[model samples]
Target chain A: MNSYPVTLKQSYSSALQAYLADAQEAALMRAYELGRQATENGLGVLDIAAVHQEALTQVLRPSSPSQETLQTVQAASKFLAECIAPFEMTHRGFREANAALKQQATQLANLNKELDAFAYSVSHDLRAPLRAIDGFSQALLEDYLDKLDAQGVDYLNRVRNASQAMGRLIDGLLKLSRLTRAEMRRQPVDLSATAQAIAEALRKSQPERRVAFSIAGGVTANGDPVLLQVVLENLLSNAWKFTSRHATATIEFGATWQDGKQVCFVRDDGAGFEMAYAGKLFGAFQRLHGRNDFEGTGIGLATVRRIIDQHGGRVWAEGAVDRGAAFYFTLEP
Target chain B: MNEKAILLVEDNPDDEALTLRALKRNKILNEIVVARDGAEALDYLFGTSVISGQDAPLNPEIVLLDLKLPKLDGHEVLKRIRADPRTKLLPVVILTSSTEDEDVVKAYGLGANSYVRKPVDFDQFSEAVRHLGLYWLVLNVPPRSKGR
Candidate 1:
């Protein structure tokens, strides 16, 4: 029952009065001006309709002759239609903006694909020069072991080590970039089996690392098996690596029902990170520990996040400074 | 001991030299023939290089093929090798960087005997070269020369 904007109400009343006074084209012209003013005042179609109805009710006399009332009603309808001209124009404006937005989206997608191809080509070619550097450094060491002093040999070895480190970086970045470009195949994958297999392989790779894995059996998920495997590999390997200092540690993997959806988590009792820097943990090349304490390219969690995101899931981490770290993800429809 | 030459189809001079050094250090004493491009490799195998005045093809005991090259890349060379009856059975081992590379899968599909990822660490790479030499040259017997 509250009145509309006072200025809109006043202008609408005057416009109707002028229309009734002569029913001339000039009087109706004021109706269009009223619409533009209404829009400027942030009045919508509903507000304008309210204003028109109230103005017409006041202009009509209940005691008027039927003939005069009919004429007044017809004139009032025409004025209302004219007053909504700005609303129609607003609709057309939205449609055109939407079309432009869609076109730009398509252009952006094409540009992203081109960027991906360029990055892939660059990463592919980068390996050759890196390999040559390492190979030549090795050649220097093997071919001239006795001719050079220990310091020279050490320098050559260092060169080889640096090149190999770059190789690892390139590999990590390549894998990271390809996550988006690769075609994903969704299937019913036995996550437990994949986790067990990864655990077995990790143990085989370094048998001296004492760690116990507690993985739930029959854990399945509908996703791209190859991609899910990558997620588990990165997460589990992170757990295995961070726990290297402990004589014995525990790593757990399983899923649980959280708010009626399946949430999977990987947890390890290892050298955990601070809650303050937890946000930076999933960023590429963002490391929390020094290289001397831990060896990683800081790509593992980022890889996990990307794959989970591709699967329409969310991933997050929780940890303290020294207790341990736990990563959780949810896959839902 | 296999006396035939080993054809190395490589475009990068650094890779070519490194492969030579790796194989030589591993006691792969077979004569190593270098072809700098895919076309040159095809030329050596088909013996069609009239400019070089070679009339007969010298079949290598094994071909260490790289994926990327200047002309006719590795897959094209592999296809031609399989297409021709003379060199169809030639044992070609692919040298790649990583298993993640899809090119390795395509290489396997094109009838490669084995693939060795070239590790950036020199010692690991040397070990890989040694294993390849041991597997192909010493342990496994080469197919009898086909009426050459």
Candidate 2:
């Protein structure tokens, strides 16, 4: 009957309306969860978008859907899309930032490699001409000694000395650059034994000088033996050199606990530097004293700083002018 | 017996002059043949060019080779000399200005009889040359030549 058909249509419309509401609620919940998960996992925009499209399809695919149901599905899909817009933008920003960081890392590595190659070539090429200059000066001195006056010979000697000093500078520069390029191998190094040996050598070099050395026994550190030796040599030699003018100097190589960390120090009773110029102490070619007053290339402390930095350590100096200086360094365990 | 001859392979004219002067100062007094580059050195040793067109090939007692050369590096030249049966045991000494550790290890690995770093100090250089000449030319006897 016509009445029965109308009743049946009414019931069907009510059921479809209820089903659409439930579907919309469930889809919204799922979308909220997906957005949360995407944000947590740092999921890409395209990946979340694909997942969202699949979810929308599942939500939209209904058996015997009416015209009103189809419209609701379209409306729900648009809402879900808008909901994910903020997440998509955030993911895009993260991806771009990560890419930029990777690019910067690669650029830094390439620049370091180029610097190493430049240093190597400079060491090789520069030494050749320097050797030539020094050698020819020697030849002139030996062969034409009688032809030239004493003043002329003295000038040639000065030239030779200057070239030799330049050679030492080049060698120091090469060593400093190599420290940056060389791979570090860490092991337990006997700091006490190394310090004692260096002190012995320094004493032997100048037997006339009376310097008391107190090296702490059983002091150990984890670092490259060769590099650590270089560090000690520079520190101890600096101590020895600066203390030369003293009537009797005392150099102490010891380690003490400071702030729950082992701090190693090289202390000397000699001509210390002013606190004002302390900032310039570790810079390459930075000399507090005149070249005439002290013979040095001023690259030693710079090399020390570089080596310590490579070892993941810190170094600093403390002193007053004309007073003794104490250099302290610490290595990470 | 004819005084033992020496082959001085050096490309840099200044280095060549200094080496020659050092050798003379050390009183080496041996017949010295100067080759300007690696190719010329190979030519002299292998008897392949105008320098080696005589009836008999020139056989030097020792070869003082510089590392950096024009055509071939000292390592490559050393490898070739070691590969050849005639010059394999020719007492080749690597005499160069390179202080690089890799150069030293490579030279020795390539079967170099001696690896000497050319000192910057002329006096030390002369002293090193004196010791080298005394040791290689006079003290240590060379393997009998195949031609001999």
Q: Please report the candidate that would top lDDT against the real structure.
A: 1
- For all candidates listed, what's the TM-score of chain B alone? 0.91, 0.94
Looking at model 2, the pairs that clash are: none
Relative to the true structure, candidate 2 has a C-alpha RMSD (angstroms) of 9.3
Please give the range of 10 consecutive residues that has the lowest summed lDDT in model 1 chain B: B49-58
What's the fnat for candidate 1, on a 0 to 1 scale? 0.77
Worst 10 residues of 2 chain A by lDDT: A1-10
Query: Interface RMSD, all models, one decimal each?
Result: 1.4, 1.3
- Give me the overall lDDT of model 2: 0.83
lDDT of 2 by residue, A182-266 (tens): 7899999999999999999999999999999999899999999999999999999999999989999999999998888889999
Checking candidate 1 for backbone clashes, the offending pairs are none
Instruction: Give TM-scores for every candidate, taking all chains together and pairing residue i with residue i.
Output: 0.75, 0.81
DockQ of 1: 0.53
Off by over 4 Å in 2: A1-102, A257-260
